[model samples]
Target: MKLSKEMRGFQDRIGHQFARPELLVRALTHASISSPTRSDNQRLEFLGDRVLGLVMATALLEDDKSASEGQLAPRFNAMVRKEACADVAREIDLGEVLKLGRSEMMSGGRRKLALLGDAMEAVIAAVYKDAGFEAAQAMILRLWASRINAVEDDARDAKTSLQELVQAKRQKPPAYELVSRTGPDHQPVFTIVVRLDDGAEAQATAGSKRQAEQAAATALLSKLEQKQ
Candidate 1:
């Protein structure tokens, strides 16, 4: 089956020339569009997740021969997590090519992090099925080169670092509370407050609760560091 010009352009952007264009189409088809004749990307997402894990595991070990599993584990999580996959999807403009049903489209499904991440994984599985592991690995490594290189940076995300610090000090885990929510349902701003038992606290706002929590943790950590 021939692909539309837009999808072809997307293929070029991702640097994968699909031998089975149908797989690409299927990968872009979301559950919201499921029907008797149409299939969603759920199964493909499952397979692609394993494919991604294998590729990342091998890549991590190759990059550092002496690193322990403890060291590599968090890095692997940072790379393969849903948010990371969603970031890659955004980079490729995968959302634009997604085939969402009317309700999904109405609710901004294209920009949804979960949807984008799942679709990205499905696309990876499609590449693997259409070609082979070699082709899929090549695409993954190429697309994820920057993230792989910056694994250390990801390892130090504010929430994790803050947790470690508090644990070492024999304090209760930092508590995150939703302070407020603003804006429309489609584009909401979340205000999260991160507070320590020692009376230190910080508040931050972002498009998502997770992001807001991270920001709040970062702010409080910085303030604590300044005192020391």
Candidate 2:
């Protein structure tokens, strides 16, 4: 089967020319749109997840030969998390080509984080199947090079790290307060403030309370680091 012009453009963006074009089609297909004859990307997502994990693990070990498993594990997670995959998918506009059913399209499936991340993994699996491990590894390394380089900072969980820092200083744990929630219920924006017992505090806003809390914690951590 011939690739559509849009898919060809997507190929250029991803720096991969799929020899088996049907693989790309399957990769782009969502379960919501799948029929008895047509397959979805779920299986491909599973394979892609494993392929991504192995590549990330190898890269982390190579990047930090002396690092312990404890240290490397977080960095690997930082690179392979659903949020990270979604971010990369957005970078390449992967949502633009997602094959969704009418219901999914009406509900804005293309912009959904989970769908985008899963599709990204499916695409990775398609590439791995079309070519081989080497091709998939090269594509992943190219796409994720910057993230890998920045993983040291990204691997640090702001909330957990902040808690550790305050506890080390003999302070009470940080508290996250919901300042306000705006936007529609379907897409609410949360404003959160993290306050320490000693009065150090930071505020942040995000689409989810957890993200807002993490942002607040990260901001407070920055301030604490500055003072140290």
lDDT of the candidates, in the order given: 0.92, 0.91
RMSD (Å) of each candidate, 1 decimal: 13.5, 13.2
Each candidate structure's TM-score, on Cα atoms with residue i matched to residue i, is 0.72, 0.72
Provide backbone clash counts, one per model: 0, 0
Instruction: Give the range where candidate 1 is weakest over 10 consecutive residues by summed lDDT.
Output: 64-73
- Cα deviation in Å at residue 134, candidate 2? 0.5
lDDT of 2 by residue, 106-208 (tens): 9999999999999999999999999999999999999999999988778866788899998999999999999999999999999999999999999988888
Please state the error at residue 185 of candidate 2 in Å: 57
CA deviation > 4 Å runs, candidate 2: 157-228
lDDT of 1: 0.92
Task: Give the per-residue Cα lDDT of candidate 1 at 114.
Answer: 100
